[model samples]
Every structure is written in structure tokens, then in C-alpha cells.
Target: MNEFTMNDLMVLMPYAPIIIVAVTSLLAMIAITIQRSHFVTATISVVGLNVGLFTLIGQITGVIDSGAVVASAEQLFVVDSFAKFNMVVIFICALACCTLAYAYLANLKDNKDELYLLLLLSTTGALLMVSAQHMAAFFMSLELLSIPLYGLLSYTYMRNRSLESGLKYLVLSATASATILMGMAFIYAQVGSLAFKPISLVLGSMFESPLLILGAALMLFGIAFKLSAAPFHMWTPDVYEGAPAPIATYLASVSKVAMMALAVRFLIDSALLALPSVQMLLVVMATLSILAGNLLAVRQTSLKRLLGYSSIAHMGYVLIVIVSIGAAADSISSMYMAIYAFTSIGAFGVVTLMSSPYRQSGEADDLSHYQGLFWRRPIITAVMTIMMLSLAGIPLTAGFITKLFAILAAVQGTNWFLAAMIILGSAIGLFYYLRVMLTLFKRPKQFIEFDVAGQWGIRVGGLMVIGVTVVIIYFGVLPNSLIVWSDMARIW
Candidate 1:
């Protein structure tokens, strides 16, 4: 064979969607030089994202099932079907974010050309995190995903709560990053290499080593922080409550998807999920998250805060899928994740559209604001109701089918006890979900009418929610298309 050299890294060059996003950010900045209009920047960002998404489709189309695209043991990243699937999800999320941002920013005054650029760069980071194979890429992508969000969280400068949320995120995220780095240091000391496969190989032989356990524990803590699983999830409610509704939606949906994909990649590939100790730890976390999230959400009056807790619970269910199934059942996990993503985006998008900058923008969290929603915007209220029902896992909604897969997978992978608990949790969640729906129908004491029309963009986004809700219900009724593709797209 020819001499091994760094030049071989060129084989991985086809993974250009990550770089495309970075380049798009630069192009968006140049839009400022040519025309500093928000519309111009938004248009450019949307077009660039469209192109990037198509490029990923072309790259993965025929080859995704053949196996890892670039299997080299580089100390940084890997390109595989698993990563490709996640890249697809990330790209879709980015496209949706741009669509919503384009529409929303057109009305807001403070959003300059640079906001689109920041969004693109942030997406690039999330993409990288999904494909990352080692500590360096992991840390780099994690921070990339976060730094722009800090600014984006505070984009609504006039809103003091937005600024406060950004600052809180910055501080808490920094601590999480530090914990990850320290954990990585321990791993490097134990294995002498940061490549995940190599570390796993070394760890397999020394399973009982204290150093190995310590490193794994630390890594677990870092991942838990990223996943926002209970105990490490203290910042979620505050951040969700304080951020712009759209941005909060992106964070809760897309960002979590990327992180969970990464977590799946690490656990499945590293053979770490099979460990009894690790499995036990995740079980406890999942149980706590499910109980805490549902119980807390029932008491919350603020929609965002309720959603924050709901997300925590949703993640708990997703984790149960991850830990219960090994590589043989990864497609089910991805399918569940996709359903969750669509439902979350739809639900949060409803929140964003319902709360207008002119009226409910800063006050989006107050549930009373939606008191007379049924009479004001019938289409939106119906769409929101569908999404809420789906989330609550009522029969015939997308959420039900997706959740069914998770519960089924958990049952197949373990004893009936786990399935029983998950079912119990889902049942409890329905109560709160119905409570919100009841409030929507509760007639205001007086005839209260709210303005529903602002611009076509808002309406269009609302339509998107309706469209997604229709698909969700369709899938729930007939889940074969998603189930087939999910089965075929095995991560391991």
C-alpha cells in the first residue's frame, strides 16, 4: 500500500454541506456590502439553504445504504449513513428556520443582514456535531451550535427577558463545555487517541478500569447536559421562556435533534449503550425526566415553560428508545425522532405565529393570551389543536404513531415493566395536553377578538403547520411509508 499520509483526508471532501453553510454565511455577509436590506439577506439565505439541501440529497441518494462513505479512522470526523441521515434532518431544520426567520424578520426592525449569516453558521455547527467522530469536532461543533444561539436568543434587543435568557444560556453552556473538555481529557489519557472507534477498542479490553469508568461517567454527564435530560436540565425552562418564540422552537426542535443524533452515534458505535452501568444511568435519567417533565408541565401556565418541560419528557421517551434498542433497531429511533421533530416544529411554529410582535410578541408565554383564539383565527386554532393532540399522543395523530413505535421498540428490547411505565407517562401527559385544548375552547367572558392577519408570511407559516398536522395524522393512520424508510435507514 502507499504510505499513509494526511493527504488521505481528501477522501472525506465530499462532505461539503458543512462547508457550504460556512461559505453561505460569508455570502450572506457580502449581501450587506451589496445591499444591506433584510429582504435581500433573507432571500439569499433561503436560496443558499435550498442549494445546500439539494446537494446533500444528491450526495446521499444512491450511496447511503452501501455503508460508511469515508471509513478512515481520522481523529475528528466520519461520514456515514448515520451521519448522512442526521445531516438531512439538520438541513431540513435549517431550511425551516430560514423560512420562518425570513418572514418574521421582515416585520421586526432590529434584525439586520447579519442575523441570517449567524443562523447559517449556527446550522453548520449543528451539522458538524452530528458527523463528528472525535472530541475535537465534538467540542468545536458544540460551541459553534451554541455561540450564534446566544446572539440569536438576544436578537430581540428591546426585550429584557431575551437578553437575560441569552446571558443565562452563555453561562450555563460554558460550564457544560468545560465539563465536556475535562471529560475528554480523561478519555485521551486513558486511550491515547480521541477517535471514537479506537477509544472503544481500547476501552473494551479494559472495561473494569477506574480510568475508563471515570472517563465514561464524565462523558455521560456532558451528553446529559447536551440532551437536557433531567438534573442537567435546569436551564431549559428559563431559556425557552425568555427567548423569541421562533428561536425557542428551533432550539427545542432542531438543536435537540442534532444532539440526540450525535448521542445515538456515540452510544451505538462505541458499544457504550450495552454497558449495564451506562444503561442503568440512562434509565434513571429517563425515568426522572418523564416524571419531572409531565408533573411540572401540568402546573405551568406559560406555554413556553410548559413546552420546556414537555420537551424534557419527550427526550426522556426518546432516550428510552435509544438505550433499549441496539444497532439492530436504529431506524425505529430515527423514525420516532423525525415524527417528534415535525410535531415540535409544528407546535412551536403555532406559538410563534399566534403571538404577534405588535401585541403578543413579548407576552407569548401567557396562556390567557390564547383565551379567545378559537373565535379569532379558526384555522390556526384548529392546527394548534391538532398539534397539541398529536403531542399528547391521542389516537389518530402523528404523535400517537411515533410514540407507538417508541413504546413498541422499548417493549421489544426489554421487559414489559418499562413499556408499562412509558404508557403510564403518556397517559399522564394527555391530561395537560387536554387542559390546554379546553382553555382554547373556553369562551372569553366577553366577546374578545384578536387580529389574525399581519402578512402573507405569517399565514404561510401557519399553513405549514396545517400541512404538517395533516401529514402527521396521515402517517398516524398509515405509518408504513415512514416505518419502511426508517427500517431501511439503520444507523449502525
Candidate 2:
């Protein structure tokens, strides 16, 4: 009995980082009880996340290769390779955001400490979402992630636009949450079990019933809403435009990744998603999102809004490989997701650096703000160009490699039509992405001296991300190490 307990402990060892973060969050909250310092809280959070990231790396090889890690805290969570990978990604985003926020929020007044607390708690929620194995755990984690976002979006409490954005998100998210609960109730009624693996066993047999189909559809709707896919993405532009740049970056990068990771886990693990109708639904959604997102982005005048639409389109590309799921294609989606996460972070990091805390009311919008950026911040301008090019699927960047994988997976699925649309969409996307790049080089009406402050941390982060972009492109050209790694990690 003692041997069995020790073995279980070994399997569950990798998730200690998550536990540490949660504890550290509580400690920060307690610190607030005595005194309030947002920078100090952010410092503590960054340190914790950095330590956690190192610990996670230490455990990845052994745990992922030959063993599984599952941590149960009152049976609400279970961490394994998939969850751990996502948690690491989330932690990296969190660390960068904290650094950015330290600079971005230094000027803001009111509830700054509370903002840091909310951010940490929300991250914990996202971590829980990735690890949830049952319906109750799923619903709780989803709420934990969303509820904090409502506040985070409106952190600039006195601003009317920010308040409006918060209200819009709160209402829509509440409706979506209700829809998810109804679907889950139906699922429970049909399967008599709320656990994922168990429900998956009987999902196919239950699909003939309308209740099951409706439940699955509703559930997809809710999750899709979370992902900011088109048609359900009305809230994104407003939220992104109203929120501060750092918060916008968080939503654009880490928040979306966590939800996508959860979606991947569900579709792959839950056998019900294999039903023809479900698969077709997903494929159609991906197709429409790719087409519409690029087209809509072409008309956006605001930088944040354009990126919001661009993000939706990127999610569509990720969905292409996701819909083509099979043992032969798993690595395609994972690698694509990794590159997407990195590029999004880099892009948003640039945005945060460019934005002024005391800028215009709608600072999140108006691409004109980037006018003459090249003359002011040459290095970041170059980095942003690389990021935009990568996002547009240009050669010699991470985005290009990821898009190649998606296209390959789509071709293997025999969806030549999807391949064609992806090609066409990439063409349309290039115009908008390049339009911004052109702005960077454009000669402004007056030689404006933008008073942008320099932070070495951001510069270092941006350069590191650009270096990664170079490697991503290099791998595309060589097609050796990345392919081998993907091949090794591939699982149905």
C-alpha cells in the first residue's frame, strides 16, 4: 500500500508548480491585507511563475515520455503532459504580462493590487480549465476564468468605454455560460456520467437522440464563443479596444491559448466529437472563420481591432489541423499552436510598448497611432514587421512554418477545397498585414517625435521572440529537427 502511494506521488510530481503559484497568489493577497503595492505583487507573481517554469521543464522529459502526471486536489483537477505543456505556455505569457503591466500600470490609480490579484487568480482558473476531467470541474474552471475577465477588461474603472466593454462581455459571457450549463445537464442526463472518458464511451450511441446532439452543439457554441471565433466574436473588438494594452495582450495571447488547449483536449479525448455531424460542423466553422476573419480585418482602421480579427483568423487556421485530427496529424496542431502563442505574444508585446498610458481615450484603436513608428523606435518597428509578416504566413518566420503544417494536414485530410481557401485567405491577409508594415515606413505629415520610454526587459523579450521567429523560419527552410520532434510527439 505504501509503495502504491509513493508511485502515485511520483506520477503527480510535475504539477507542483501550479500548486506553488496558487499558494503564492494567496500569499500576495495576504500581503495586500497588510499593505498594497501593485509592483511588489507583480514582482512576487513573476518570480513565482519563473520558478514554476523551471520546475516544469525539469519534469517534462521524464513525465511526458514514459509516465503520466495527475494531481487531484479534491478531485477538481488532473494534470498530465497536455495540461503541463499548456500551463507552461500560460506561465510564460503570465510572466511577460506581469513585466509589461509593471510598466503599463505604474500610472494608474485605484485597485492596482486588486488587479494583480485578479490576474493571478484568472491564470489559476485557466490552469484549472486545462486540467479539468469532469463536467463540474469544467464548469467551475470556465467561470473562474471568465468572471475575472469581466473586471480585467474594465480595470480603468472611470473610463466609460472600458465600462461599456466590461458590461458587454459580462452579459454575453453570462448567456454563454448558461447555454453551457444546459448542455452539460443534457449530457449528464443522456450519459449518466459527467467524466469525460466515461461519457466518451457512450457518446456515439447516444448521438441518435436529439437531446445529445443539441447538448453537443450548445457546448460547442459556448466553447467557440470562448475562442472568439467569427459570428460569435462581436465582443472581441470592443473589449480589446477598450482594455489597456497589457490586458489586451493577455486576452489575445494566453487567454485564447488556454481555451484552445482545452478544446483540443476535448475533441481528441471525447469520442462524441467524431460523429459526422460534429466534425462537419467544426470544418464549416473553420472555413467560414478563415474567410470572414481575413476579409473583415481588411477594413479595420484600428490596430487592436485588426489584430483581434487577425487572431480569429489564426484560430481558424489552428482549427483546420484540429479538425483533421488523427495519429498522423497531432503534432501538426501542437506545433502550430506553439508558434501561434509565441508570435501573438511578440506582436502584443510590441503593441504594449508603443502605447502610452496617457494616450488618447481610444488608444486601443486607430492604426494611425503607429504612423512614423519607424523613425521613433526602429528596432521594434523591424521586430513588428517580422511579426506581422510571420502572421501573414510570409516565408522565414514561425507563422509560415505553422501555416505549412496546417496546409499539409488539410491536404492529408483530402480537403483540397480547404487548402485552396487557406491559400486565398493568406493572400487577402497579406494586404492588411503589409498595410501596417507600410505604415511603419511611411513618412508622416510632420516629423513627430514620439516620446516613447525604453524598457530593457521589453526590448530583451522582443528580441528573444524575434530570435525564435528566425528559428521557426530556419526550421521551415531545413525541415529537419522540428519535423523529427513533431513526428516523435505525434499521437492520435
Q: Estimate each model's TM-score.
A: 0.92, 0.91
Give the Å shift of residue 475 in candidate 2: 5.5
What overall lDDT goes with each candidate model? 0.76, 0.74
Clashing pairs in 2: 327-492
Residue range 207-292, candidate 2, lDDT tens digits: 67777777778888888888888668778888887887778877876788778876776666666666777777777878878887
Give candidate 2's TM-score: 0.91
In the predicted model 1, the residue pairs found to clash are none
- For lDDT, the strongest prediction is 1
Leading candidate by TM-score? 1
